[model samples]
Target: MQTQGHDLVSTLDERTSNIRATIENVLVLPLSRHPSPRSVLIIGCGIVGAATAFFLARRGVDVTIIEREGPASAATGAADGAVSVASKRPGPMMVAALSGVALYRELLGDGTLTDLFKPRSTFVVAASDAECAVLEAHAGALRGEGVAVEMLAHETLIARFPALSSNVRMGAEVKGDGHAIGYRIVNRLLSLSGVTVLRGVEAYHLVEAADGRIVAVATSRGELSADAVVIAAGNGAPTLLNCDGVMKPRKGQLLVTERAPALNASMPGSIMSGRYLLSKGSQKGAEVSARGYGLVVDPLVTGQFLIGGTREDSDARQTNDLEAVRHILTDAVAMVPGLADIRLLRAFAGVRTAVIDGLPLVGRLPGRNNLFVAAGFEGDGICLGPVMGQAIAAMACGETPSLDLSSFDPARFTSLEVAA
Candidate 1:
């Protein structure tokens, strides 16, 4: 990290030595520039901000990212990394997910993320008729989008995974889905994509020019100049942007079991309960219904089954409650009988950003020309981040985005009071 100023590292340890070499695989750059920047400043280092920075850099944009912590330190760190499109609801959300699938394909094709982009099938199993209906409809929706889906009957599903409880009525398999380690991809994007980063600084205030356009941001590290800013800071976005209730935090708990003994064969991808279908997006008068039943029995690459999760409409103070863990595991054991014998290692939690309307707020902020908002992705951030990043970048460059973002306008719910 070659910085012209000593103040940049005044409070740092030796980790700032190479910036990029701090981690074996991470790449980092310091805040250094010639004249004032006409560049864009992204206020998060999660998947969305990272992808936005990557695309912006490709467009010759001088990018400076101000991350309160390190990259992938929050929501991105806690992601299951499932690139499953079937999990997306119908309409614009699914359309963006299709774009995400295409982006993953392009990224995989160019060897950008092939190694970490694990191509695996996603198995969604239903234990009851109601769930079977949901699974059947979900498969039809996926097939409607031209996604390859294979529906399985109860008997056929048993033949595939005998360890699965007989209660599982049916299942659907989507072969094209892939999973990636969230933090790994964050580091890979930083290493391969060009962006200057200032870690441990919270972007506090937005400085405006005489004509009222955003010119810079005041961070904990001091004022960093900018021409445009993207608020992809996830759960922290509301406070930073003063969007108030626009972006609320949704809490979830997950458990990682000890390495499994030799499994029957490798379980095909992840085994999602029909309950998982209920949690895809918000339901009318049913926002709270998706709280504790999205159980997934995911066998990780490390032979450890990654069991999860409980979606609580709570604040950042929520932890991995024991009862929630018990409930999640109960659902897991019901779906996969063998999981009852699996030793539990640890239980953890993460907060996802949810909007009032259940859709992400993309494009420029309501009242500001240069302030773009890409928060409120909730649990779908891992799937929609790449496409949203590209679309937001196109909007920033004054070009028409290929994705129709009219429905996702950040100002849809309320008219922001900043500028018009």
Candidate 2:
């Protein structure tokens, strides 16, 4: 695939050069540029931070990523890596998802990061009438954006996925959505030229000057100075920020199944509940009310089934909650009957940094010129990683983001009056 894409790029370049006279006749605007930062300190080496470092390094910016543990050891290491556009909300989120998919496709063509991505179909099964209604609404909204969404009736869905429960009323299928290997992506990005990966060094606090620009960072190992800093520390951001309203931790528990003949077979990308889809922007009425379950069964290249997860409000780092694990497994079995025979392999948990608003804090910090943030992605960090990285690099380089960032402003939580 990499060779094929490269050949296409070369062929296109050659052909375009053949028509150089016509190309020269076309008008083009001067590209805007920014003074590159002398150095950038990224405070996490998860998927988000690693990708951010990769993008910044690609632009000739010096980037040092400091991780308390090894790269992708946090949420990125634990996530199921479902890169599904169907999982995202409509409008801005849909646009971001599409852009993120495109970026991943481009990366897939490089072979350097090929192990991190794979194409798979995704399905959303509806178990009840209410769920069916929600799926209809979701499919309708997605189709309006020209996204391919097929709504399958009960008989068709059951025939296609015999492992599904007979109670399923319908299912929504999205063809282009797929899964990626999160840890592999982290490794690939960390191997880039200009990225310096430092582990076992916990960043404790941001050292701000009188002018309110972050000048240095105080870590357990030592203090490091950089021209700019990005706080991509996932759930650990609140401790680093020490700001009451910046962000909070939301815990999610997941369980994995040992590879079995039934489970090892090729499966769709992922299946999300309608409740989960509509719960994005607003959490007020979106709380999982009934049994509170959303199960995503992702089949990895290694033949293991990555089944998950349950959302909780507590910030505890507990990974072995037998009850929560059982709930997740129970819900998963209900969604995919074949999963019932699979033996439980392991269970774990991770905390996602969630802000009051659904959007992530992806730009420069308010009042702190040199301090930038790309946290508060909740559980969707994997789906949004590449795009967020590109956007953060643009902000660090003083270039305008391709998308309007007002909706994700960190100031929405930390106001001048409140900070004062």
Candidate 3:
């Protein structure tokens, strides 16, 4: 009688398991049959590459992001998260920045990515009457684009940012501008579902078919075959692509200050000089007037202050440029008097992948059917990450991107013969 009872219980348990399995299959059948999913291989794990992986994974693409060392160990790791509209070019880049800001705000509201972002006002200070006029024009142009901008006098600028030096001539206040921590954002995106992050793996070459379709990627560890691949390896991209003169590594030095009470209270948001915000294309005509220095200060939530940086037009990996550090520190202290007393904590450097045309290359590679390129962000990768990822994922999935990306075409710098 005891043996018969045990057998009956086992039978009932098996029946319950079968019922549950049937229900699960019924629930997942529609989704599985919607479309055949394709696997994607992202070549870098910086902000641009990680964010691209996140966006693609969210769209149900099987994503595997391979990094040489670790996530954000390159430019994204050392970036100062200044998501400012002032830093971008006038047209499509600016539009994309604004769109990314909106997406960040939405993510914050949804509590999905709140820890990665912080909302703060951004200011552009002018040091002379000419710069003040330029600020006025910039403010007007931003306002014309429906962005919230306020022009403030020197006195008003001093009052609003009490830490600002009295020599500030004028300022433009952008209400919605803020900063996002880059590495944190990358980690958050990596933790999402449908994404596989492989650190300490270096991508070496692209394995393409005779038809010019990328079929596999050769890496230091091994080969990874994918339906599509995105090259976002920052300055390392040009080396991997074997494409000459497509990307160059521009070094930037930054410094951090020990946590200080005086500096905490006067933490002015992302600050920029009017000349620094001028179009890079206009630098040739105003080379003598342009200052190679820009100051950005943010009082991190940890109480430590972040200050940066000097754009050095070199590809070297030397981070200990004491002269550049001294210049940056002097300018930062000049902008925020309270920062003068702060103790120097540490200094670091990052190489920004810059393009000759001063815009990131996005979209499919010319003559390559399944390969894509999304690098050369320079200093704006953190700000441009989301939109670039969205565009890349859209192209991979055969969907139309929400934003127009004509300005970021890969063939823009290439001749017809080279592109073909």
lDDT of each: 0.75, 0.71, 0.73
Q: By descending lDDT, how would the candidates be arranged?
A: 1, 3, 2
The residue-by-residue lDDT of candidate 2 on 1-420, one tens digit each, is 112334543543443343233223432222222345756789998888998887876665667777898898888887778887887767667777877777788878866566678877778877777677777877887787778988888898877777677977889987788788778788877654335666788888877666666666777765666778888888767677666565666677777778775555635456665555544422224553322456677777777788877666654474657787877887788777888877888888777777766678778877776678888887788878877988888888888988677777777775422121
| Each model's total of backbone clashes | 0, 0, 0
Which is the better candidate, 1 or 2, if ranked by lDDT? 1
Q: Where does candidate 1 stray beyond 4 Å?
A: 1-38, 282-286, 418-420
Question: RMSD of each candidate?
Answer: 6.5, 9.1, 9.0
Estimate TM-scores for all models.
Answer: 0.87, 0.85, 0.86
Q: Who is ahead in TM-score, 1 or 2?
A: 1
User: Which residue pairs in candidate 2 have backbone atoms (N, alpha carbon, C) closer than 3 angstroms, thus clashing?
Assistant: none
Span of 10 residues, lowest total lDDT, candidate 3: 27-36
Minimum summed lDDT over a 10-residue window in model 1 is located at 4-13
Q: Which regions of candidate 3 deviate over 4 angstroms?
A: 1-37, 278-291, 415-420
